[model samples]
Target chain A: MSGNSEMSPRRPRLAVWKLASCDGCQLTLLDCEDELLAVAGAVDIAYFREATSAAVDGPYDLSLVEGSITTAADARRIREVRAATTTLVTIGACATAGGVQALRNLGDIDDFKKAVYARPEFISTLATSTPIRDHVPVDFELRGCPISKRQLLETLSAFLARRTPNVPTESVCLECKRRGNVCVLVAHGTPCLGPVTQAGCGAICPAFHRGCYGCFGPQDTVNAPPLLTELQQLGLSPPQLERLLRTFNAEAPAFRAAAESLGAGGEK
Target chain B: MTERTIAVDYLARVEGEGALRARLDGDRVEEVELRIFEPPRFFEALLRGRSFEEAPDLTARICGICPVAYQMSASHAMESALGMHVTGTLRELRRLLYCGEWIESHSLHIYLLHAPDFLGFPDAVRMAKEFPEVVARGLSLKRAGNHLMEVLGGREIHPVNVRVGGFYRAPEREELEALRPELEKALGLAAETVRFASGLEFPDVEEDYEFVSLVHPDEYPMNEGLIRSSRGLEIPAARYEEEFEELQVPHSNALHSVRRGGGSYLVGPMARYALNRTRLLPKTRALANDVGLEPVVTNPARSIIVRSLEVHYACEEALRILSTYRRPEAAFVPPPATFEGGSGAAATEAPRGLLYHRYELSRERLIERARIVAPTSQNQKRIEDDLRHLLERQIRADDATLTDACERAIRHHDPCISCATHFLTLEVDRR
Candidate 1:
């Protein structure tokens, strides 16, 4: 793709799309400060608003979609994005699950709107914030509140190689154990989601002497029931457990089920 | 009568989704709208019923570019509500974390997002093909900032370390000292950045701005200060709502903030530098003087220089904190066991400008209500005002030229539209 010969086919066109998100996942690409120019050389950045003003008409080779489908226009836009790209990869919790904003999914969205805006009537939003996969088929989902840079690079490299990305599906516990650190849950009696949460963030919270807050969402084979039980035994109140499950990946199936089973339901 | 329209379907090189529209009637400007189409996540609404301790992490999601600003503002507000003050090493650590953010965020803007316009490139990637060393310096400088954040806060983007009252864990002196060499290199690079930015040709134009920023007595404001403005308006964070009000407009999702019973005001690098010029470190102050940068820069286009100067200040500040580093006994000062249920407010200087957060907590420590006024929301109207003036001057320019100029002007403030309704597309209608 970096060939200089005129006979070489043009580089794969990469387009980045944002729906409703903090713009973190895409920033991860830019944050690859050392590798950004190389990535650019490997792919033609057809569209990326946060980094470049230039754009090219798309039938892009690959599209990395960030954020969630939170508005009617965004819902419509994602379809257009899917239609324009050959491969669509959803980045971050917002695109893979529904993200922290999905807390509104469990509540009365009208009330949610009124709580923030003085003229709630003026705001145009869907009742629920949902991941990109819910609206359109996502080729792959890279998970995190803000995804890990290493994982992001791996995913991009995988796309260029036409191979499956080597992101781990194991829980944070495995990563924590590999780091040779004492378990905060076992040693400190802290309520931790490391046992159920996905790995990618390098088990940061635990290393910092805190329990995992599950920013990477649920692991592939989560048995959240036992973890909740353990948390309860560790002195977490029922409301606290429910609240913890209803954070960054609030609407991820596993977490939502766990929170719902606690009877709080994340709803009024 | 001739009618023409310039419409930018999507605005690029900005943090989030937004568009712009301007209408011109003959030579007079009819309207300028800095449209923010980014879907509102209803952060303030969702924050209710969440634990007070969750504020820092949750609010950090507001903008990827300036998560530290949100974290700092939320943490400080929660601390104020609980009547807990983090002193000594912990306080210095917060400033240090902020310096890392400023360095990273400012470098991102100067080199990647904003510089392309001045250098006649589409983006930094293209610019890199020709000016590899320049872009490399920027990326290296950004890496230094990110490395500092990683060592201290655990990760750069949405750091997992910051908590109310203090940090989840304080890095050892060695962990911090490891950053000194890179920071030293970054300081030199940042100085080069100021010089590089100063060489850019700015339009000889100035705006009468009511510049607002945090003013600290001892240091350049980052984590704490009185909210002061160039117009002699000084108030605590608690009085932020009294002085400024967010008004919802039909064209955009982000609310436009203006001084109460007054018009639009400016914030960010220009505001901070103008308000706290003397408070900058001696080296940074000397650099600014050497570059012949005015004490009070009123031209929005010259903000790139101010932002570069801030990057220099942040580097120096980070080194200063590192030089005197000592790990606090506790990772955090735990909140009081019992709660009386109170409210608190705080304003911190985000790389862009002042970010204000207020929270009302229940006796059970759950958040009852929350309000976040992002810098871009405050600057949105002022940005439109700047656009209006720019359009007036370039009235005879073609649609594409006017549209390009408008986007450049908006970029001048480095508006984080994600933080604003928390934001561009451009439309110019000439009739």
Candidate 2:
């Protein structure tokens, strides 16, 4: 908890890992232009493949893991991450839920890959992209396509403090209502996932007068079925309801279950 | 003779995952492979069955730094698919947004990533220790660009405010005015950046390049322009596929692109500068000349100067857009779509290079086929060609020197391989 870089010599070594998602999440650390140098003061930066060539041996104090476990290699790699770090924080939707790419978990991944590649045999992957928690324990999970910058800063701050980061587990409605933004769904009759989706992103979509598409995944407790019923009453067909749930955080358990049940034949 | 490899296990000072492998046969320069091993996301595959509306969000995942490029290009292509023509204020806003991307992306590369190689620093953070003012200017310039993106697109990366037809929300007049002070300051920094880069000690490396870019009339190309190059090649954006082709290289998952019958070509800052130097506003063009960068020049090593000049141009253009800002009533106009009968292809000048996207949407509006040609891919063979010749010159230099030379050569273009398997691996071999 002390801010002494020299006196408290064990400057907790940090390592960043990536799996089946964009490198944006880890780049958030590098993109910390204002605090990058000071950040290096707090950590040995033992291994961050995205940033530097200087890497040290790690039974790291902190490991910031990005991306989801999509391939079998990633599934195996998460174990190595958990083994290497005392505190493992998974950042972004890919690491927490299966990410937007996890939409394949709803269908056949092999078929998906084959449809894209000329030689699908060359590709190696698992049929599903699952969250980091599915394979190994994650000390914390930061949610977003690339994770929020403030959240990342807080998470790093917490690790340095040896306390849980102050990430709210509430719904997007709270952030939206706090921002005093008009409800896109309530006022404009837009079918939004804000009611079921988690906070963070400052309820960004709704603040801009657009309904939430839930880039931040589900809240700690979401009644997705009830939300689906609301969407249905607002004139969503069964497939329309399914498509709504099966986006961004499609592999998150509640949304995943909601997608399957809603996508079924004419679920009127 | 013993074989020595100057290997950078993970490529730094570049965008995305890549490695370089240089084979040395007693300094004869056997082969140099810029291996791009970044995992593929199958964006083109995921795009299928997706509404043309989803293209921006889906394809934006291809690269983080150049997400705006992906979004703009995808939006333009899909808009074309719908037989929509956007112009006036809406079109100007798109160009202004692109100017922001160019300034941010170019300054980041020219200062933080590419400049260090020339300045003999490991990275910009280290370079700041010696040249704090320069690095500060660079960050400020980059911040100005991010501010523009935030004001317009919402977030700097994979901005959510963008939709197929237009923005989910349009910036108000005050939002555009808020950017003016920062932009005016950015203009000064951009000029200083050119002076800094143009004065950098460049290792002598130049090659014959088929320079490619989007050329426009009365404006430096950004969002809307015809694809053209210094080699007298001209094609409408719609003919990008017919003019250029992509082929899978053995060492990469991303395909290399070239002129249909030609060997290799250059894109990105250097190429854009050489091809469209005249189109730049008076001040930026003057900066190019004052910095000893004449369009007729053939020095690839001096590409840094070109990128810096672009930083100047982008800053100036952004300020112009801001000063003349009138908040449009609508962010986008819904254009009509006539499917099957019409095929649309368009290329935009992404910060990296000319990003081309073409689609054959069937009558049912399902994507029948998709073609994407990233700037990194277009520059691949040209990079290898540069490596072969540049390393040959440094054949007598020590392994470290020669290897660094090769890395510098590849980084000169600021390649982003994520768009290709996606961008750089640094390997140096000497005998």
Candidate 3:
């Protein structure tokens, strides 16, 4: 068996999609100010409305989807996007863990809508904002409120090279230790999610003298119950701890379960 | 007589999801809708009960393109409620940080999003193939802004350093010094950008825009000022709800803002420039005049020029702030020891337009309510009005051309619907 010699290989076609998001994750790709032009050269960039007006019909090689699926149109659109892409990677907390907006998933969406909009009847939305994986199969998940640009570049590089992306799934505590920053939780009595929150944001909140609010979702081996207990001991009440865990990557399984276990319930 | 509808299901290039629909009934434009389909994030609702300290981080999530706007408005509002203001160096640093956003956001719009439309490319990558130097300059200018943010606020996209009173930490003078050369280069590039933007082919369209912006007595408005309009209306930020009201229209999730009983108004660079042109630094003012920009420009398409002028001003301002840099004794001012509560409102000039945040805090300093009015929401009605005007003027153009031209008109506003739908998407239907 041999590869076809007559046809030349083409750059991988990349499509960036947004559903319900802050546009930060995709902006991360553009925020690669040094590498943006080079990255553009390596990919076809078939469809990315936020960055370009040029759109190509897709059967894309790789699709980086941002935002959670929160509307009826988006639900159908994700299926269409999935059908049109060979490998679909969901980027950011919204796409992977339902984002900050996912707080509505636990509450009455109507009340949420009414609270935000004066005439809620005019608004169209799903009852809950859910992750991309909830609607369609995702090949990979890149976590962050706005994903780390380095990780994003790596993920894109992996797609271009047809290699497995090397993204760590360790807790933020490990990252904090690696950076040699003193533990805000252990040393300063600050209630932090570093114990269970996934690494990637470089322990940013902790480095800033604040507790990690878990923008990167949960680590692979998250036992958030223990972290919640620890937080309670550090002066965070059950309600405060629940609100803390339920931000950014709020609906992640480990964090959600922990919040529920603390009697915060599914309805925030 | 063709009675047809032209619909754009999703607007490209502009930030966030939104659609535009225009219906023509036998050459008469019957209906024009700037449909903002960006899914609602319910930020105003979710902010309730959160600590007032968290407002900056939370509201910053509204728009990746202009997080500083949200952060500034939030911090200012919270500061007002707490009965404190970041004084001297702290205030200057906040202004410096805003200049970074102005540079970044404006450059992104001018080079990547809006420029491509004028240059007849699908996006900047394609445009770069033709105008590499221009694109590179824009990116460099944008990076300078990002570098400033990184040094001051930690990161560019969603800066984590900002709090209610000030930043978590301030940049060292040496750290700021390192950014000077790059910003100097950006200053030159921004000047060239003004010349380039002024040279773009603009449609012969102008509107009697009721421009609104914050105007500080002594400086260009960014963080603090009374909300003033071209219509001679002046109000404190607290009176924002009274002067301007949001209409819950069926076509968009984001409410359409109007001047109480009046019509649409313009904001952002054009508004800021038109209303506060006298306050611009000499170099920035020279660049604007060199480009033949009038003190009060009404052509919507020429907003690109205004943004370029702003980029020039921002770079200069950033440099001035950096050169006079004295790190504050403390990174942030602590709130008052007393536990009394109050409500406060603030309007800041986001790169795109005005961003207003009104917060009602409890005695315990928890946010009882949050009312955020992003610029895009305020500009939505105006955008539709512009489209309607465009259709009336170019009613006879081919469908493709009309759609392309309409998209261009919307781009002039550089509408960050993401800011609004939370803010946008575009659809055009002609029947």
Candidate 4:
């Protein structure tokens, strides 16, 4: 299990980097309260700014990057981060897709700036929020608005053990059935993305009697056109369906295409 | 005259990114700037023209550490705008949900983020090596809180169940009952935490600062209250804009919140403790007494103690509510007919402090205007002010020592900068 890390006398150096998004995905590591100390014991947290003040000079063994490349400064900073790591893993929807803030990807950045700030001239932002892969190569991508804690642990464990992580690429419907949850879509006529959405969140929305909001982005083999047609039947207007697809994982290609096909721009 | 520069290019151990710079001539501190470089996501701008129903989930994305605060504040504001009120057991359930967030967020700040600074550790991971049991206790307590959130709201981060009127579906009686044993265990752990925190060596520093928070008449404030401050200022949540103003500075994307008549004031656990000590539940009050925490805590670093006490209160309150929880006949109240073309404002006690959300709804139930003032943004000026005070006192110290002290000082507010540049940089120049 300790194959790769054991090659060196020192522990594998791990660094976590942030770009522009909610700190949720990075927080998932901290939320590993039970396993955090153990994870630390297993590796060196060389540069995790949000969790520690101590930073070790990097040519890091593994890097976990969060957030998306939103600002020009971040665009350069991510390149620097890429140069310093052996293996890079993008965590959360923001890193994997463009995240919710990427809602800007489909609309006017200038108008967005003016709406949010009094002096839009002071703000410097990219026209669109883009994922890490758009700018740099990523060895792996862990998905979710905030990636599921169990999946996060598995990813970390696989890295520490020097093995490829066994992550499911199946749809959320499989998870819903596994959990014995009644399908909210079938029973209540609620529009749900569960059929095409990824499974990492364990069908949580259906358990709560709410339709899946697709926080995990899209399933690998998604045929979202059918899901959109079903949602239309279940009373989701084209605009409403578009808004649903463009939430946390807003700029993910599959979801983005689905929403675009519906004639709705990403902006609210 | 001599000049030297002490710079921390990146401020660490806080949520999000920010920078701090201070300039001094000899030992006289000249300028202090808490620069927030966390990229602005433009949440307030994005909320414009969206359905009011989207507010809870969309705003919850603002800060992952305190999603409940955003959700509760958004829900309450929308509910008020619709002229629909959730009361009785449903109201209690919402408070219970908030209590869960309080326990989770406070435990995280106190143990994982803030405590390592108090001790001589760079992070909690290092701290755990020396005091594994204490760290484990904190983690378990935090997990218990997350468990409650998972059961009620569907997931800890950006819970899916919370809607404007109420939850999408209320938890079954057994679902709540299942949390009892864990809460009981957490109660004991929280008690131990309060005692453990009380014994920690606190830095002997106090600043004369104004403390502000929401104060409920009958209960410790959570979802509802009147905005009050230690400086004899009291106003309804609707009057927040009337009392305070947001100033735009070139260095920060967040607007610095300053009172109309006064300057910067504190809003967080310290503020809540100072303003609502009399309103604390009985068990929490006794623990505060045992811990020797004064009603007015002036030391920012010692705010960890206040956070622990709040955790105790949250655990106790959650238990108190769960025991009598009866799954409501209907999960939520349907919105009233008066839901069109109205304005609503609400002040809820975020774990950090008072979070205010104001929304103007169009007749179509679309959000025409939205303004959200996160607690961290409100406390930015106060944080900078505290840094200046600390810098003046320790102006003669060496660069490394002084920079470390200043970083610890910023951590005192448990500043969620992600909530504020949308907020740290630490740099010191001495002459």
Error of 2 at B275 (Å): 1.1
lDDT of all predictions: 0.91, 0.76, 0.87, 0.88
Superposed by TM-score, candidate 3 places the C-alpha of residue B352 at a distance from the truth, in angstroms, of 0.9
Categorize the docking of model 4.
Answer: medium
Superior candidate under DockQ, 1 versus 3 = 1
Evaluating just chain A, the predictions reach TM-scores of 0.96, 0.92, 0.95, 0.96
Q: What TM-score would candidate 1 get against the native?
A: 0.98
For each candidate, give the interface RMSD after superposing the true interface residues on Cα: 1.1, 3.0, 1.2, 1.1
lDDT of 2 by residue, A115-184 (tens): 6556677766677778889898778889987688889999898877777899998999999989999999
Best by TM-score: 1
**Candidate 1 residue-wise lDDT, B1-431, digit = tens:** 75556567688888898898888888888888888999999999899998999999999999999999999999999999999998899999999999999999999999998988998998999998888888999999999988888888989999989999899889999999988899999999999999999999999888999999999999999999999988888999998998999988888888889999899999899999999999999999999999999999988999999999999999999999999988889988999988899999999999999999999999998899999999999999899899989998989998889999988888988989899966588988777
Task: Give stretches of model 1 more than 4 Å off.
Answer: A1-8, A265-268
Instruction: Please give, for residues A75-144, the per-residue lDDT of candidate 4 as tens digits.
Output: 9999998999988999998899988888886668898888777888888888888999999999999999
Judged by lDDT, which candidate is best? 1
Model 2 spans > 4 angstroms off:
A1-6, A72-77, A107-110, A264-268, B1-7, B335-342, B362-364, B425-431
Q: Candidate 2 docking: what grade? A: acceptable
Better of 2 and 3 by lDDT: 3
Look at candidate 2 and tell me the lDDT of residue B100: 81
Q: Candidate 2, residue B36: CA error in Å?
A: 1.6
How do the residues B356-425 of candidate 2 rate in per-residue lDDT, one tens digit apiece? 8877676756565666778888888888889888767877777777766777777777887667653565
Scored against the true structure, residue B10 in model 4 reaches a CA lDDT of 80
Model 1, span A14-61: residue lDDT tens: 999998899988999989988998899888899988888888988888
What's the best-to-worst order under lDDT? Answer: 1, 4, 3, 2
RMSD for each of the candidates: 1.6, 2.8, 2.0, 1.6
